[model samples]
Target: MQVAARGPAALTSGRQRPCRPACAGLWPAPTGLSARCRATAEVEADSAVAGWEEREERGTRFVAGPAFYRPESCAGRDLAVLAAALQRKRTGRLRVLDVMAASGMRGARYLLQADADEVWCNDLAPDAAMHSTMTYNLCTAAAAHAEAANAAPGTDPAAANSHASNASTNGGSSDHSAGSSAAGGGPVAADGPAGAEGAAARRQAAAAWEARARVVRLEGLTRDVCEWDFPPLPPASPDPEAGVKAETIASSGTLGAQPSDEGAGTSQPTSSSPGASAEGRTEERPGPEGSAQAGPGPGSSAGDAAAPVRRVRITHADANRLLTNCFMREDYYDLVDVDSFGSETQFLPAAIDAVRFGGLLYLTSTDGFTSSGKRPERALAAYGCYPRATPWANEQGLRMLIGAAVREAAARGVVLRPVFSLYSYHGPVFRVMLRATSSAEWESRHYGFLGHCFVHGDNYTLGWRSLAGAVCRCDSRGKLRKSEEEPQQAPADASASAVEGSAATEPEPSASPDEVKAPGPSGAPTPTSTPAPTPLVVAGPMWTGPLHDAAELRAMAAEAERRGWTGTGLPKSAEPGGNRAKSSRNSRPLQELLQLLIEEADPRLAPGFISVDDSLSRRLARPPPRDALIEALREEGFAAARCHLESRAIRTNACMEDVLTVAEQRLGIKRRR
Candidate 1:
């Protein structure tokens, strides 16, 4: 059968859901950077401390010693830095809270590279020695960063780091404050000023930037939460910033956990440094116990003028306890980064509340199985979405994550929208940058169910209120069967209009099943009284909105270009999937990746992509070049582009028939049938 000349006009026309969101963005449903530097990473046989290793990434050198650092994950870090830097540029005061700072590398970068006003790095590592190592690396790194914050943009960071190291060692005292930047960055106000960019700028320019970091001892807390005998985070001090500190563990703060088996019903006691002033609103952390300690907190001397005052704090506690303490203290951060190993669903509520309303949340997930449709149980347990395997499971992973955050925020009477969604295949990691808004303008339409038919090649979204009916056409076989042949069922309730008084806003194909004529022997639309019903696989309570916000992508690309972050992020010696043995001939620049992401944001393009090789190339005697085909599709008035999630795939408003016609006519490729 010859494919249809015109694809679904309604899908392409109407410019299809104009969410080219502006910078401030629109909630209509309601709502809502950095690092690309490639510095050769040289690993030190031994760091300053015994048995500790040092490594460099994106031009910043830090202690990689005995901590969880994945060199291949540098691309994600690069993105994180860019995002943090951009947030700082916009918000003026960038204070970051690293929930699980396994080596403090990310936190160090936040201070050194993103210009974070202060960073509180916390890890659950019970190793006192390893904890000391993280503190030292973070403080010294912060010291150098703070000193060079105002130095010419071209200042050599290594020189400043060397100077700070020499100064700290000259004192022969292991007190962390010798070259600390923590003393002068001002108090860690329980409630920080969110939009005081003008004031923050003046403060930054008037005095030297400071980098200070401290790691606390946590021996009482059990390494395993299943034990439950350990202490939980105490309740908040009604007004802690005013100087009345809350008791270390008052036992009143509730754990805002979801139905996750991560860990439960446990807590830990917080201690305060002896003889230190209350000027720094740090969470209570126990200090040294008569010189048996691994290291002491940053210098308590308020008069250290040479150190230029840094403000970073590191601790040994689970993410829940640490963030709960922050929430109790009202010590909200400009950005909260949660880079969990599996999924961050359990931490979403606490992390969301810890942000300073309108701040950023950089959340990550590495559990591909949850969204692979192989384990709908895990998906439901984690993000409340029942995911099933689809050709586009990767994109589903991202959407699943965003939908979780959006629901969490809305439930808390806050609003959240995605700034960007990223998926990398190394660990099959999924990360998203979300901007939280104090203004609540969430529409249920944005979050709903998704359905894909086994027979039909198309995907559809079901609205919250309009759930009963979905209508899908055709098959995934890439050819139209003859009208006289037995017909397959239409997709299950893909189009909500299957029932009366339905309010689903998703548009349908311009042509109806019962058109003026029946399909010829060649592939074409057929006349039928009613569409056939096909088996449908549905997954939802997930985000049904555009994958990305284009306005934000434009800004992020500009930020990446400005930072000269051009490397693909993985080491040139390593393949993108982190295998050094594999050839990396296909590695592209960071800008190229960003550009593809920007293109993927085209609102006219639909949700799932059509795999060229999987869906189309087999049908054509000779498949057309992907780029040329995309160009031709565009010329034919269809919105089409390269899909970033899957290579050799096309994301378009064009239906299967239209695509087949394009291959049959524009490119002069003969169909096999």
Candidate 2:
């Protein structure tokens, strides 16, 4: 092993410095501390290990090496934990893969906080590759020290001191000063050890440091870091039956050979060892030939084996190719996170393929234009669904994205049930988590089309059925009578004539060329149904199923509440000041958003939403407040709740006419048209 020496300039004054306090063993300081102070401490401690600065956020310490790190992403990191927790009930060991791990922060946190058994942090950036390696070394060392300390409860002071002395000698001369300073206030005597108590403390510290160095050695022996470009995915198979086989074949071509260690490799530690500065130093020490590989040391408990391993293999390769290889190997991951820069559509297929049955798949899409209906053609081409320009575009966009993922997975005999979905207006991205399973029947039932009527602001979900001749109530033009099974309600205050006039104003239905015709007894074509003069624009072959699993969401909410994360800006009942006050008290807006989503989720509910303002825009009188509308619906024995999709929207089982009647009576609004 070859180690580099640190210059005097890197050392603090000649006075010895105490061992920086370890927050919970080798893990960085706990979260909630001042970020700046935590960062400074981390830098001071690991300066000898690498050149990059470091920062701690949400209890995870990340080095600001060559990769980009954003403090604002802390909330997203928290959501990742929540997602993992939701999946923990279904799996014993959670294997995670961060396809675009920039600083390895997310992956590291998963290991430390999310009960992950293993994490593969892969990044394409050259700087990230180097920094991730260093991060793994630093974290592993801390873990080893923590384990060693735990394993050895008590020892004779003299023996501990002797152990410390030997550790200091092997660690190189640089660590001597740090150890001595930690022992006492001033410089140590030339010959004798510091006072007995001080000597023992210093020795213990030195032993821990040396243990970290040994771990780095073991890691270097077993793992290899490689830099290789990810190859393009093989062309999609034209035959549905051959799709899986073709994908496997293509993956082999792209990643058949083990990657070579092209970039900076892990060098062996020097004789001077752990005491050497970590900065810009490269060591190359080959492992003993034909020696048995090392694993978690004696200190590791059986329980610790199930926890995330400290060692990691940092690979610099294309994210897509890496995912494809995982699929080809049948190496299914418990959790696969694909946080791409833009649209995640390109990676969704591979991600779905790589996740194990009953596992979780988390995806993020920043391409709002495509999913939000700003770029309809792109949305259709990418998601195989049409995105409508509506007041609830953000929510629609999220569903469209989810619908795309569902379709992609279903094509490969996989069924993905959405567990959680987020349209973070703040982050301006759509994030979703789904549970993967294999059930062709379930997939068929879960995917369908949504037909929306702009004229009456009504929508219907058509599951596994043709959309031909579908007409909204407003477009029936009195040809189709209202179903007798439909509940009838009297208008709150509108005159009978006013109600009749409102119904008459609807445009006449007309026949469309696409309508499917069934022959009558004589084989003559069935009547050509006329299309509504004001047509109901078909919005999707998109996911018309429920956007959330109600039971799962409720369970998640309970977990959040247990963790003291239940505060949402939403009102639980018709309470005043509660919303504003609770919102004010919420330190975690992301959690609040999640809670709000849970409170509003209903699997029986349909997809589209009604914007109270947009619906009553043509009315001459002022529109009813959102809360008032919800309150009125409930009073009338209808189930109504605030919609997470839009601020001014309410979701309810009540018909549009009933909602409007309630609004008119409650707010004194009158339709002008």
Best-performing candidate as measured by lDDT = 1
Off by over 4 Å in 1: 1-51, 149-309, 474-526, 529-531, 574-588
lDDT of 2: 0.46
Q: Write one digit per residue (lDDT tens) for candidate 1, span 638-662.
A: 6678877777888765556556667
lDDT of 2 by residue, 1-673 (tens): 1121222122111122222221212223336768897887655434323323333444333344446564545546666765664343222235577888776767655644443444666666644224333344234323422232233423211111112222211110000110110111121111223343322332233323322332121112222232111111111112222233324422422111111111111121112233322211111211111101233211111112222122333454567866775564344566798877778898888888777555678888878777667888888888887777755677667777888998888787667777777665544677788877665534444455555566666554443334553445443321111222244452332221111112211111231212211101111222368443344456666665556665555555554444443322112231222334443211235456666576566533445667777765644366578888788766754556666656677775454665666666666767556
Off by over 4 Å in 2: 1-75, 128-311, 463-466, 475-533, 566-591, 666-668
TM-score of each: 0.64, 0.60
Residue 564 accuracy (lDDT) in model 2: 42
Alpha-carbon RMSD of each model: 20.1, 16.9
Error of 1 at 472 (Å): 1.2
